[model samples]
Target: MPNLSTTYLGVPLKSPLVVAASSISSHVDRVQMAESAGAGALVIRSLFEEQIQLDSMQLDEFLAAGSDSFSEATSFFPKIEHGGSKEHLMWVEKTRKAVSMPIFASLNAVSPGAWVTYAKQLARTGVNGLEVNLYSVPTDMGKSGSDIEKALYEVIESIKAEVALPVAVKLSPYYTSPANVIKQLEQHGAGAVVLFNRFLQPDIDPDTETLVNEMVLSNPAELRVPLRWAALLYGRTRLDLAVNTGVHTGRDAIKALLAGATVVQVASTLLQNGIPYLSTMLLDIQNWMDERGYKSLDDFRGKVSQKHCDDPFAFERAQYVKLLSSIH
Candidate 1:
């Protein structure tokens, strides 16, 4: 068997396939199952700032109403139970004790101060690393791209200054210039970058005139966007790249490595196909490596990146030109 050990963000992983942040960590049994099944690492479910703020507002409203019945409403605030920065820290510490594998804590913050404060607290939890789930929808027409980018940088810098643990930023694909944003993030002390976090999009029901909020898992086709960006950014920056969003199989993970990704983070696939599927994925990668006569991940990783590939223009040039020319 070939060695599958690889390093991500300076932390050694048993393999390159990490279990992305999802409902898997909500229960201890699920997390242990993932490890036993062969996950390299695991990111705990994200603690969303929006959910915390909404709960706080509800608690305040209940208190102001001055109803004795409001006492029971306090349970609605998960932060008071398992969602606060301190509570999250404890959870990480507990999870670390439960499993020997590397565990990374995740946080979704809206403000720079909250980002810094929570990152510091999470660092004390004994996690191997931290993942910043940074996301914001630009609903205001007055805000320019520069303004949004500045906010992202400020948050990254604040968190970097406050914590000693390795930090990875999970970004949205809606940026006007993702390459520039990633370059700036690395300059500001980010250890790694997770390509493309899938956002929850709202849909409208025209017949019923209702709005719907759904949690749709990513499909395999979603891998192309990150693959192209990873190829273009490889050898250009120092930060490690972990591709997420649409990675569903061992072959998909191999495609990401060929595109210069340091590791592949998967969630939707494991959710769709039970946790044990991770073991099969790792086995498949090892078998492929053996057949190719590659003993280690570094032997073939990034061999097909834009900088390494013969047809560099294929990743950037418009495909329409080829289609139109061939039609004649």
Candidate 2:
């Protein structure tokens, strides 16, 4: 059997397959199952800024609802706050204690202060690292690309200053200069950059005239986008690059490694196929390595990247023209 060990964000992973942040940590039993199933590590479901804000507003509404009708009615109910980030922090702490494998806490905060505060608090949970989910919908037309990027830089800077844990920024693929954005993050002490976050799109119901938001699992076809970027940016940056989205099987994990990813983060597959399926993917990679006479992951990692591949243009617009002409 080939050695499957790989280092991600300065942390040594027994394997290169990590469970991406999702509802997987909602149950401690599921997390333990993933560890047993051969997951390199698991990121706890993100503590979102919007969710914290919504919770605060709801608490205010509940506290003020019956204050006018009957002052005593408000007193009868405890002034305790519920649905806040306190539960999330406590849950992360609990999850950290439950699993012996490396566990990273995911955080998504809106304000700079909140980013620093929450990141610091999450670090205190005794987790291995932090995945700063810079997940947001940039709808402001007035905001220039530079302005938006500056805000992201500030968030990274703030978190780095307050948190001692290894920080990996989970970036949105919407940036005009994704490479430049990553360069700044690297300069700001980012341990790793998860290639691209899969931001959910809201769809409108034609008849009902309302937005319907739902969970949609990624398919193998979606791997191309991150694969190209990972290949293109390979050898160009020092920061560890993690591939996320579209990693459904062992072959899919191989594709990411070939494209120069330090590791691959998978979520949808485990959701659709169960956590134990991770062992199947790892087996596939190992079998393929053995067949090829490769001793370890590094033997063929980035073997097909732009820096090492014969046809570098295959990852860029040059291939688009070639592909179009060949189709007809």
TM-score of each: 0.92, 0.97
Report the Cα RMSD per candidate: 3.3, 1.3
- The pairs that clash in candidate 2 are none
| Maximum-TM-score candidate | 2
lDDT of 1 by residue, 231-263 (tens): 888888899999998999999998999899999
Clashes of each: 0, 0
Q: Candidate 1's error at 318, in angstroms?
A: 5.3
lDDT of 2 by residue, 126-198 (tens): 9999999988888899988999888888888778887788999998888888989989999988989997899
In candidate 2, how many Å is residue 138 off?
1.0
